[model samples]
Target: MSGIVVFGAGGRAGRAVTREARRRGHQVTAVVRDPRRHAGIEADGVRLLGGDITDPRAVALASEGQHAAVHAVSPFTGPERGFAGLDPEFFVKAAEALLRGLTETRTHRLLAVGLFANLKTPDGTPVLDDPALLPPPIRPFALAHQAGLDRLREADTPVDWLVLTPPARLERDAPRTGRYRVGGDTVPDPATARLSYADLAVAVLDETETPRHHRTRVSVYT
Candidate 1:
């Protein structure tokens, strides 16, 4: 089977996608900023390589001949880390590099993990606009994520891309139920909308192996 190259392989979403891809018997190239720091991700049928997601040449080098690429790279890990040196255009730059590099390598598919903050409420207000739903301090990071999504929408590249946005309550230790529902650009019932990282991986690989959504972003939840 053709391999899948995953950027930000050390991250939670990226790691889950890598695990699910291997579980489905596909070769995986796990790209991170430092391979030595992610030795735990190395295993049978997986190759760990160091590369920068914001660099087009590095993206092409890591993604050459792969079946698809997953963009799970995030400049901001968490709120405690704060936005000390956050670049507002981080995702925009990533989108540009991925489009250029993937098109150059002839890789036709790009699956990106998206933030739920940009999703709209029932009344059509973005989740990021609601301070109760999303803290005010985190708005910058969410906006950065939104910029990347916008960049993809504005591009005319041949690379087929999809962004899967998970709910706010993504449980790290929850079991994989192997089931999920896809929704539009609105936040599902915040009370009941939650997803396991494992199940999110299932949705990601399901779309990767047999894409049902194209050039669009969708919310995935349990």
Candidate 2:
């Protein structure tokens, strides 16, 4: 079983990933901003790390000895999900922390949980280039997410990093058929549908173990 650390473990996707990791018998650590707030994360088998991802020392200490780590942090903040207060500094700091953790922990592989808006549009153009797709309000969020992807790529590190793009329609309540497909660069499914949070969790774990694509961006959908 792989030893894994999931950043942002208290969030929707993070919780699902942790749960599925345990079902597979992997030693899973759920790193969170506050352990007590996520009391349910505590159980017989899982290890919990309490701290903010903004802290380099904390991330390094928590990520140590893990085989692979998944970053589930959202670039979105506030009700508008706007980047009104968005600071690249936050993510830059996070990059430092994650790099340290990967180095100190000897974790050789990491997967970035990316967003769908970062995917290209129908005309085969990068979505970030199309204003209509992004609109006024959520545009900043899209840009920030895109920037994060860029940083992940440029950051110098020994660990292999893979970016996973999720469809925009991804629904938390979607039914789990345990069925899905993966496409690269752009969105895979023409249907433009959502995968169950459960199913997304499955995809993340599957990629971690099998890793068919390395140093590449992949999209998952049902």
- Top-lDDT structure, candidate number: 1
- Clash number for each model: 0, 0
TM-score of each: 0.97, 0.90
Encode model 2's per-residue lDDT on 97-160: one tens digit a residue: 7777787878887877777778876568776666665555665676667766777778777878
lDDT of 1 by residue, 1-222 (tens): 678999998998888889889999989999999899999888665899999999999999999999899998998778898987889999999999999999999999999999989888778888989998899999999999999999999998899999999988888899999999999898767546899989999998999899999999999999
lDDT of 2 at 144: 69
Whole-model lDDT, model 1: 0.91
Clashes by residue pair, model 2: none
Clashes of 1: 0
